[model samples]
Target: MQIITASQALMPEGWQSDVEIRIAADGRIAEVGPMTTRAAHHLDMLLPAPLNLHSHAFQRAIAGLTEARGPDPADTFWTWRQQMYRFLDRLDADQVEAITAMVFMEMLEAGYGAVAEFHYLHHAAQGQPHDDPAEMSARIIAAAQIAGIGLTLLPVLYQWGGCDRRVLAGGQRRFGTDPDSFARLHAGATRHLRDHGHADDRLGVAPHSLRAVDAEGLDAALALCPESPVHMHLAEQVAEVEEVMAHHGARPVTWLLDTHDVDARWCLIHCTQMTPQETARLAATGAVAGLCPITESNLGDGIFDGVRYLGANGRAGIGSDSNVHIALFDELRTLEYSQRLRDRSRAALATPTAPTGRRLFEMALAGGAQAGGRDAGRIEAGAWADLLGIATDNAWLCDRHGDAALDTAIFGGHGQACISDVWSAGRHVVQEGRHIHRDAIRARFRAAMTALEATV
Candidate 1:
């Protein structure tokens, strides 16, 4: 058992001060109160570490490489994807393990206690199935294990390139699958996880998106993992929304909500192009709207109506998709800034005297855990013992206390502050601002990237 005290912490309503949290060996919170008499581990800025609700782990390495536009002046997500295809061809199982470990390390340091990896790169470059169908998925799982981050391994079912069963293009080959192949691969990946996944690590299903998967395939994947967390890329781009409306006679989320019983079990990533009616209907579904504000901005994707959606009481969380940026503060800050820009208002995420940081943290934490199928995202008894520490000793945070500290961290601060310690499932993965496996993981990552540079 361990009890750590905080000068400030994020509780249900706002930042509470002089709080103590007790963690049991089984990774559950033993107790949380104003004070604790228990003897054990201690931390400084203890708060609920937010879950990274969506990621493609391998994209971390190639993040900066896609900045240059092609011959066309207006390159977009479709254009950037060509670079990604070439990047993945350089990765085998061993290389994937190296890359994934580094990615998860960055995530852990970025205050993500857990990740819901939307893994799709499975087959070889030519689209041929690997000897082990889940070879790539296992590599990602291994990376999570190495990093000691909670894992929700979502094996994506990408059945088609379009509405028709069209053969995937050169770059998409690695992510292709028929429904039956996908089902088999998903099962193998699940079984592999049962053997090697980290404790508290779990499995889930991703239908890639409506475009990458057909109706029947999506239905089957959902049925296959009825109880597991279901994630899908929704309306991120206007182009995608147009395509969905063209094919399905409705927007993606609109069609899905009307067709399927989308409850709390689902997480719809990106839902950027919702109509007023669709937004209202979606808010009633109780599903998490997984938003990647920074990534959305980078991809030239439009913003989701955060004000309208939250006003409707919709659950939402953030992710570091594309791995272009991996800072938790950046994601949260960008989210609020986007909303402010859209609404043309100041202090968009803030209330009269309430802390915007606390509210955003609470919403993201709650929604992220719900999306990842975890009994966490809170500093309460029965919640998992996941906490992140910030360095109050820093000059920028001087004289700040309680909610103001969080306000500084999330809104005022721009880059990584001294994250002195990070505890996942009551175990310390980072101490003194460094990950336990940072050195080793980084070595492997260096070697992997060197090899990748040779090919890509």
Candidate 2:
């Protein structure tokens, strides 16, 4: 068991002072009460660490490599995707594990205690399955174990290149799998996790997108994991929406809601292209809108309609999609700023009871837990001990208390520096603003990048 005492802590009931928390051997919070004089790890301010609802861990390796403009007049997500595919063709399982470890460590340092990896890269370089069909997924699981980050492994079903059911070519070949093959792969991954993963690890299924999976394929994927979390990329780009419309005769979200039972267990990634009616309809379905603000902006994808969506009590969480930048506070700030920029207003997501920063933080906590299907997002007994320690003495947080501290940490643009410690499921993996295994992880990632650079 581990014990921690915080001068201030955010509990589900609200902020508490002089709180002491005990983490059981099983990684759940054992107890919470007023602090005693017993020896315990001390924290200046403690907050619940949220799960990153969506991520493609390998994409972290191609972060800055796609910034250059192609021959097209306007660089868009499609152009960036081509570069990403070219990069992944050179990646092997060892390189993928190293890159994923680095990304998971960075996420820990950035205050994300867990992640839902939207994994789709399944086959070998030449579109052939490895002897172990779940080889790539096992690499991801190994990386997560090394980093001590709670993982929600989402094995994606990518059956087609587009809505027209074209064959996957080039880098897309690595992600191709029919429903029958995907079922075996999913079972293998589940067995891998059961044999090797930590207690907090989970298995989920993702239907890559409407363009990649047809009605029958989606149904098969859904049947594979009926009660687990179901995630899908929905209406991320205008081109994608148009393609779905042309093929399905309705917009992506509209058609999805009409066809399936999308409820609280569903997490739809990037509703950036939704109409007001679609937004309201999706919100009413109790599905989480997984927003990746930094990646959305970097790809030239339009801003999500946060004001209208949240006003309808929609659930939302943030993710470092492309991982071009992996800062939790920056993701939240970018989300709120995007809404303000779109409407020419201030504190666009603030409410009557909570301020902007507090409101965003709370909503992210709830939505992230719900989307990842993890029993975390609160500093309460029986919850996973996913917590962040912030230093009140830092320049960005000095002399701040209550919601003001969160506001300054987020809006002051130096929030990452204030993170002094992080615990994911009672594993203290990050300390003093750095991941505990930073040096080793960095060295491995550097070697992988050096080898990848020669080929790409």
Candidate 3:
């Protein structure tokens, strides 16, 4: 049992002062209330860190490597994917593990207590299954364990090359698997999680995308995990939307909702090209729009219809997709700023009463916990003790308090520097604005990158 006191803490209702939190032996929050007295482990401010609803862990390795323009006049998301495939072609399990650990550490330090890893890089460099079918997934699980971050392991099912159901092509072979093969892979990943005593770790099914999975394949994969959270890359690009429309005679989001029983259990990443009707319809389904603003901007993907979606009472969360930048505040700030730029207005994500920062932070916390299938995102009883202690000393947050503190943190404070400490399920994974294993993880990642660079 452990007790923590904070001068101020963000609760579900609102900010509370002189807050006390009791962490249970099993890492769940047992109780919370006013402190009995001035506790020693006192913090200036505390907030429940949000979960990252979508991430491609291995992509962290190639962050700044894909910025160069090629011979194509129109550099696009499709071209970026080609670069990604080329980069991953040489990645092995150990390198993947190192890079993933580094990413998870960064996530924790950046005020994300948990991550939903959309893992899809299966098989070997030449697209052959390793001796242990779950070898690569084991690497991810191991990395997450070492980093001490809550993980929702999403085993992806990728089969076809596109909406046309073309056979897996070069640079895409490693991610291909038939329904039966994918089922086995998913089951194997689950067993590994259980055997490692991470029984509470979620196992979700990802059908990759509408373009990658046919209706039959999607149905089969969803059937394999009925209750687990389902995530997919939705209308992220204009080309993808057009392709799905050409093949299915409906927009990607339209075809998906009409075909599947999507609900609160589903999270659609990057609805950047959704029509207004599609946005409203998707919002009505209680599914989360897993927005990765930094990545969308990096790839020049169009902005999501935030005003319209929020007007329809949509659920949404932030993700560190592509991991070019991993700061949670940056993701939220980028999301709000994107809408602001589009509408030519200030505070585009603001509600009537709540400020933009508080509103975005609260919505992402709730929606992200729902999407990740984690018992977190709140400093309340029964939630995991995934808390972040915000440093009051940050020059940008000097005179702020309550919601204003959140505003400064999100909009003005330096990335991760505003976060003083972080607890992941009661483990003090980050302190003094650094992960406990930051140096080791960074060193391993540096070595891995060095070796990879020599090859590439």
Candidate 4:
């Protein structure tokens, strides 16, 4: 049993002072209240931890390496993708585990209690299925298991390389799968995570993107995971929107809403380039829009019209899509900054009643839980006890209170002060702002990168 006392903490509806929180043996939140009662153990500040709604763990290594322009005339998402493909030339199971472990460990330290890895790198180096089809995915799951972070293992299904259903390009081959092969891979990943995700862990599915999946392929993959959260890349780029319009009659988001029976179970990653009509329609579906601000900014994907979307009461959450920098603060900061730049206005993340910082944090928490298919994201009984603690004594946060603390964090505070401690499903994965597995995971990562360099 564990008990934590916080000078101030965000409970379900609002912030409470001198709060007492209790955790039972099973990792579910046992109780939450004033610090009148005591337990076997107690600690300081606490808040529900943030969930990372999207990630491609292995892509963490390729972050800075892909910034250079390729031989292409115009460098864009496509050009950068080529660099990414070239980088993936020699990632076997061991390398995948090492990189993913380090990535998850970093996320834990950064106040993200859980991660929904939109993982699709499934095949071997030559685009062929390994003796075990889900060999790579199993490695990803293993990394999360060893790192002790809450995971929503989303095994992605990729059938085609582009809108034309062309054969997968060299790097694309690593993520391709037919329906039967995908079913086997999906099953294997689920089995790998079944026991691991009871009170603390989770699992889900991602159909890489509309461009990478055909109608038949999408249907089959969704059928296999009837109840798990299903995510997909909807409209991240202008070229992708154009491709979807050219191939399907309408835009990608419009087509998905019109064609399928999508609801809260779905998360549409990036709806960056949605039309006005497409935006309202998606809001009506009750699906969460999975946004990745830092990665989108890095890739120059156009900013999402968050102000319009929020006005429609559409749900949305932020993710570290490319794992470029795995801080929950960066995702929130970039999301707001992108909106501010797009509209040239201040407090764009604000709702009508609440302050901007509180609103953005609450939405990401709520929507991320939906995206991850978990019962979490707030300080409440019965919800998974995933919490993050921000320092009250930080230079930027000093003399601040409530929403001001969060606002200062986005617009003033450094990343380190904002991330003090993190808890995942009632377990303290990060203590006093450090991930317990950091050093060991990072050592393995360095060794793996060295090995890959030799292979290259």
Candidate 5:
């Protein structure tokens, strides 16, 4: 068991002072009340850490490599995807594990206690499966274990190249798997996690997108994981919406809602192209809109309709999709800033009772836990002990209290520097703004990047 005391902590009802949290042997919060005795760990300000609902961990390796202008005058998500594919062709399992470990460690330092990896890189360079079909999935689970970050291993089902059902070519070959093969792969991955993963680890399913999986394939993937979290890329780009419309006779979200029962278990990534009606309809379904503001902006994808969606009582959470940047505060601030820039207003997401920063933080906490299917995002008994520690003495947080402290952490510059500690399911993996295994992770990542740079 582990004991932690906080000068202030965000409980389910609201902020509490002089709070104590107890972690059971199973890593769940065992108790939450006033601090009466000394504890092994102490925090100045504590908040429930949010899960990153969508991530392609290997893409962290290509962060700065795709910034230059390609032959196209207007570089778009498609062009960036081509570069990403080319880079992944040179990656092996060891390199992928190293890169993923670095990404997970960075996420912990950034205050994300857990991640739902939308993993699709399944095959080898030449599109051949390894002896164990789920070798790549095992590596991802292993990396999560090494980083001590809660894992939601989403084995992605990527079958076709487009809505036309074309064969996957080039770097896309690594992600190709039919429904039958994907079932085997999913089972293999499940066995690995059951045998090797931590108690908080989870398994989820992701159909790459409407374009990549036909109706029959999507049904098969859904059948493989009946009750687990179901995530998918939905209407991220204009071209994608158009393609889905041209092929399916309706927009992505519209067609999806009409065809499938998209309830709370579903997390739709990047509803950036949704109409107002589609937004309202999706919101009513209780599905989470997984927003990756930085990656959306970096890829030239249009801004999501946050005001309308939230006003309709939608669920939303943030993710570092491309991992071009991995700062939690930046993600939250960028989300609000995008809404502000779109509407020419300030505090666009603020409510009557909650400030902008507080509202966004709480929404993310709820939506992330729902999307990842983790029993977390609250400081209460029976919840996973995923917590973020903030140092009130930092210059960015000086003299701040209550919601003002959260506002400063989100809006103030150098917010990452204010992060003092992080716990994922009672594992204190990050301390003093650094991951506990930072040096080793950094060294391995550096070696992997050096070799990858030489090749690509």
Candidate 6:
């Protein structure tokens, strides 16, 4: 058992002062109430850290490498994707683990308790299966274990090159797998998670996108993991929406809603191109819209219609899709700012009862937990003890208290310097604004990057 007293803590009811939180040996919150003299740790401000609903861990290594303008006059998502493929073509198992560990550590330090990784990179550089078909997946799982971050591992299914079902080509070969092969891979990976992963860790399936997997492929993938959470990239680009309409006779989300049983278990990564009608209809479903505003902005993907979606009571969560910027508050700030730019308004995501920062944070906690299939996102008795301790001594937080501190953390900050400590599954992984294993993880990651820089 562990006891921690907080000067102020954000509870389900509201912000409370002189709060004490108790954690059970099993890593779940045991009790929470007024402070007691017997305390093991203390915090100035505490907030329940949310899971990152989507990520591509390997992409961390190439975050800033794709910023240069391409030969084409019009550089777009397609061009960025080509650069991504080329970068991944030279990645090996060791480098994958190193890069992933660094990214996962950053996620924890930046106030994310967990990550739902959309892992699609599989096989060797030459497109051959490794000795263990799930070799790459094992590396990802291992990295999470090392970082002490809760993980929802979604082994992605990518079969084709486009919506027309063209055969996998070039760098795409490394991510492609037939249904039979994918079934075996998924089974092995799920078993590994069940046996080796932490109690809160989960396994799920991701159909890469509408462009990569046909209806039949998606059906098979869903059938293989009937009860698992399902994630897919949808309508991230105008070309993708247009291509899906051309090939499937309807927009991607439209077809999925018409055909599949998408519910709370489904999380669509990007619906940036959805019509207002599609937005309202999708909001009616309990499924979450996984928004990665930083990466969306980086790739020039259009802003999500947050005003309409949130007004319609839509569920949503944030993710560091490209791992370019892993700051949780930055993701929240970027999300709200994008809406302000699109709607010509301020405080666009705010609710009547709460400020914009509080509203977005609470909604993300709930929606991300739902998407991750984890018993978390609350500082309640049964939830996992994943908490973020904000440093009150920070200049931005000096005069702030309660929700005002959160507002500054999200909107007034450039990074996560205000997040002084982070606990994942009751384990103190980050303290004093850094991960516990930062020195070692950084050394390994730097070595891996140095080696890959010469090759890729």
Kindly report which residue stretches of model 2 are placed more than 4 angstroms away from their true locations once superposed.
Answer: none
Q: Which stretches of candidate 4 lie over 4 Å from their true place?
A: 37-44, 195-199
Tens-place lDDT digits, model 4, residues 215-305: 9989998898888899999899999988989999878988888889999999999889998888888888899999999999889888888
Pairs of residues clashing in candidate 5: none
lDDT of 2 at 177: 95
Off by over 4 Å in 5: 38-40
C-alpha root-mean-square deviation, each candidate: 1.7, 0.8, 1.0, 1.7, 0.8, 1.1
Per-residue accuracy of model 3 over 58-117 as CA lDDT, tens digit each: 998889998899879899988899999898788989999999999999999999988999
The residue-level lDDT of candidate 5 at 121 comes to 94
* Better by lDDT, candidate 4 or 2: 2
- Candidate 4 clash pair list: 47-387, 48-387, 49-386, 49-387
Error of 3 at 159 (Å): 0.6
Give the lDDT of residue 42 in candidate 6.
81
TM-score of each: 0.96, 0.99, 0.98, 0.96, 0.99, 0.98
Over 1-456, each residue of candidate 6 has an lDDT whose tens digit, in order, gives 988888899999999988999989888999998996736678889999899999999999998899999999999999998998888778889999999999999999889999999998889986889878888889999999999999999999999999878998778889999788999899889877887788889998999998999878899999987887899998899999999999989998898899987899999997999999999989999899999999999999998998999899999998999998788998899999998888899998888789998999998899899989888999999899999888877677784788888898888884388888888889889988889999999999999999999986
Ten-residue region with minimum lDDT total, candidate 4: 37-46
lDDT of candidate 5 over 334-401, digit per residue (tens): 99999999899999999999999999999899999999999999999999999999999867799588
* Residue 32 of model 5, lDDT score: 90
**What's the TM for model 6?**
0.98
> What local lDDT score does residue 349 receive in model 1, on the 0 to 100 scale?
70
Candidate 6: pairs in clash: none
lDDT string for model 1 (166-249, tens) is 778876889988788988899999888999976688898999998899888889999889898999999888888888888889
TM-score of 4: 0.96
